[model samples]
Target: MSTFKAPKGTYDLIPPVSETFLAVREALAAPLRRAGYGYVETPGFESVELFARGVGESTDIVTKEMYAFTTKGGDELALRPEGTASVLRAALEANLHKAGNLPVKLWYSGSYYRYERPQKGRYRHFSQVGAEAIGAEDPALDAELIILAVDAYKSLGLRTFRLLLNSLGDKECRPVYRAALQDFLRGLDLDDDTRRRIDINPLRVLDDKREAVQKQLTGAPMMRDHLCEACKTYHEQVRELLTAAGVEFEDDPKLVRGLDYYTRTTFEFVHDGLGSQSAVGGGGRYDGLSEMIGGPELPSVGWALGVDRTVLALEAEGVELHVPASTQVFTVALGEEARRTLFGVVTELRRAGVPTDFAFGGKGLKNAMKSANRSGARYAIVAGERDLAEGGVQLKDLQSGEQAPVALGEIVAELRRKLV
Candidate 1:
């Protein structure tokens, strides 16, 4: 046997299982489109500095996980480890924000690459469906983005996820909180890495998942207490709006998002059932990201839901998405003459908007019926020399084993009636 396998930390979404991923993409796109968000696509890789400046050099994503390299042309490029930075860059490059559309809303779905120690729900390559709102900053906009995420999950019948919300304060107030937090952190026993992070981003100290760190940092300063007057009012308004819209969330004072651009409103969608890797998706407002990436000043807010983790969430909750098994009728030709004649009939069916599949080569009627059964089609169009010569075909309901002889001209109508 050939010794080959899918790369470590990566997987192939194949066959019947891939239907779940398609379902997720569809479910996510429907809401965004309904909410007036247009679809956007960007390159898989960007200038290395795009992420270095946008995602923050101190963050693990850029510091370690980024798949960066110099191309043959000697240009530094990196496969995107996330979506927001690239999407925002595209918006800025295309000047979409200045096209008179305030808060240009866009949704995108694509695969991202990151190098990391593979673990459950964490991979070097992953797919995400993300949405971004650029060029506007409003408390209601924050709430709207969060609600869009929640609505997408609910529309897909996911029930085990919870939204954790917090505000990291804006540029005006975060520095003050950062200083206070640094003071508190310095008093505790911390490793060199943690200490260095304190200088670069003291807020991330609150993100420590270690039990020992959590124990000593309990009394540390919280961003909520240090938010400037405007941010305080904005946070409250966002919470109030969320509540008014019936979107539930828990206040998480320690929510320091893993990126540097996120400011003020930040949130994560966590699934209780997906142990360890419970974050199904998360994102927050980034008012400074545009400037950080050398683009025109553009305020934006967005989120990305992990398609892999989402499928796991559905499985954990015992929810099955009823993906369509067959697009249309599968025709089984019993004889050579029947095959030649039904070839035209199948073409007409397809021309009329009926998705149809037919067997090739020679197979007996019994084996052909077996193939039809395997097709997951609701109805199988069976034709033999006898039926073809009679100017008709036999329609068998695969689900019920019932058969009816119908005129060839009426096959499309007959199938549509049965399908509908």
Candidate 2:
């Protein structure tokens, strides 16, 4: 038995399944790319302070799941638990906001690490395709982000996910709501941790999944009641735009995201079939995130969809993505001379963008044909000593069991035409 194993809470992607995951990621990123979102890549880890400040200290991601450590140089760093903070940090460091583009749009896809107990839909190492639009705070931008997310899911043939949205009330009214919420929380019968959160960040209390905490929050002040005039107008515009765009969303006043940076607008994509781990993806307007991390004030909004959880959701709905076969053309050479000629043919076909595979060893014809069948190839090219002497190669359509001879010189072009 092999001694090594994948680390706990992680799995490998191989073959046909990996193909589907790649397709899902591509489908998710397509709309963003077309909508002017340039791609950005960041390191897997960053200074511990970046997330601790950008994501809220009161959030579970910072307090419980962050994989932080001290390096030999005594520098504290952490594997990124989320994408928005790292993406924003990169933008700030590069001074993207000063580029005169009202909203510097970008999209990214990579692995994110957390130290949580692994579940069916959750893992320590996971993949996310995320997008961010920074610098501008327009209702149209929010609607665009939401609409793009919808398009991605629809493109994947997903049908059961719902969007829950709310406005967290910007700086204008959040303080008033915060004080009122703190006053209300102090009077509740709660533990010290719950009480301490009131002092640090009262909004996070609304996100508590604990039954007891949720019960205590039953009478908590809803964010909608505290929306200031400007925030109310902003929220109304987002709603109007979504309606006009024919995108549907449910208003959840208690929907405080798991981050403190969210303000003005917050939303989550939930799949009903995924049981308790219902969220497939979510994000909100982080108007204060730039200033929180010591960068200039830059309002941004984005969302991160979990590739793994999304796959699970697809399974829950019994949907299989239409991933094309990896091997489009399989070659089986019947003799030594045929092997050389067929290998050249395989190389030529592959160079022409055909997914081609060829039998290497001089195996028996029966075994070689079996391998070709297992390759999931639609067509197979077979050549023999006689066939080569005749200046032709046999093209067999594996799908229909049809065989025809094509002149050796025109084989690549003929196969290209058939494959395309």
Candidate 3:
């Protein structure tokens, strides 16, 4: 082992495990693609003020968790702690909302960075597959995002996860509820940080998970009670649409996600199996976020499913994803001439859309065959000087231990036929 390692609270996705991560990402993005969401990519870092203004100054993600730094050029930047703020900034900068679409749907997959004490389901650096529908305030858009998340999880064969839904109410009614919640929080015994949060973002105080804080919040005010007529109707429509689509969700009155931008409809996906970090992924409406970040009013609803947590959920429930073998065929060349010839064969097979690998480093027949066997390849192509002299190669079925001779020209076609 080298003296160096991945930075504390970070990890490298390598080998067989990395394959599962890719599969999980694909599963999460599939629903978005089917729903007309186009792919989008953004830089790993952005202006620190972008997140400070968009993610909110009072949130822990901004106040403590964000990995912020100043560059040599005197630019303040931070590795993105979340997806929505960065994505929205990119969309607005590129004028995507002006492209004659009511809701500019986009899907993205990438890593996010934060400074945090790492845990099983939580990491300082993690991967997420997120979808956003910008410039739309419709309930169907909110419901559509939730349903898409549900479909993605189910697609990965996850059954035990539950969707916790809530409506934080819009600007018209949130202040009234905020004042009520703040008053209730003031009467409770709490730490300085918790007390300060009551004033800055009182709703987040209700989200506190500490046993002491949670006990004091027993009868705290709920957003559902303070929602105005418009918000109530909108929330009801979202719930009704979800129910109509056969998606079951529990009404979580306190599901104020750990973000300040969310408004009206809010939700979280949780798996009880992930103790202490039960939330797998979640997001909600952020209607005023655009204005907060110096852009026009573009109400948006989105969710990011954590790839790391989803993989953990799968392991907890023992749901193994179906990842096909990476190498379908492994080739073993016996001699120098055989090496050049078989290398050509490997290239040909790969160009023909066959997953092929060649035994390198000039290993002898026995060692090369061992490498081929370890490759998990279904078939092994063995060619020696004698076999080449016969203008053919030996194709051995790795599974059945059967060998047959095939003409050099027909090898690609024969393998494709066998694979099919």
Choose the strongest candidate by TM-score: 3
Per-prediction TM-score = 0.98, 0.98, 0.99
Model 2 is weakest, by summed lDDT over 10 consecutive residues, at 359-368
Clash count in backbone of candidate 3? 0
Best by lDDT: 3
Give the per-residue lDDT digits (tens) of candidate 3, residues 3-115: 89999889999989999999999999999999999999999999999999999899999999999999999999999999999999999999999988779999999999999
Any residue pairs clashing in model 1, and if so which?
none
In candidate 3, list every pair of residues with a backbone clash.
none
lDDT of 3 at 190: 93
Kindly indicate the candidate among 2 and 3 with the higher lDDT: 3
TM-score of 1: 0.98
lDDT of 2 by residue, 1-420 (tens): 989998898888998789988999999999999999999999999999999999988888999999999999999999999999999999999988898777999999999999889988889999999999999989899989999999999999999899999999998899999999999988888889888998999888888888988887777888899888999999999999999988889999989878888998899999999999999999989999999999988888999998998998999999999898889999989888898888999999999999999886677878888999999999999989999999999999998999999999999999899877
Error of 1 at 14 (Å): 1.1
Which ranges of candidate 3 are over 4 A from the true structure?
A: none
The segments of candidate 2 whose C-alpha lies over 4 angstroms from its true place after superposition are none
- Candidate 1 lowest-lDDT run of ten: 325-334
Residue-pair clashes per prediction, in order, are 0, 0, 0
Question: Where is model 1 more than 4 Å wrong at Cα?
Answer: 1-3
Pairwise TM-score winner, candidates 1 and 3: 3
Question: What value does the lDDT take at residue 92 in candidate 1?
Answer: 87
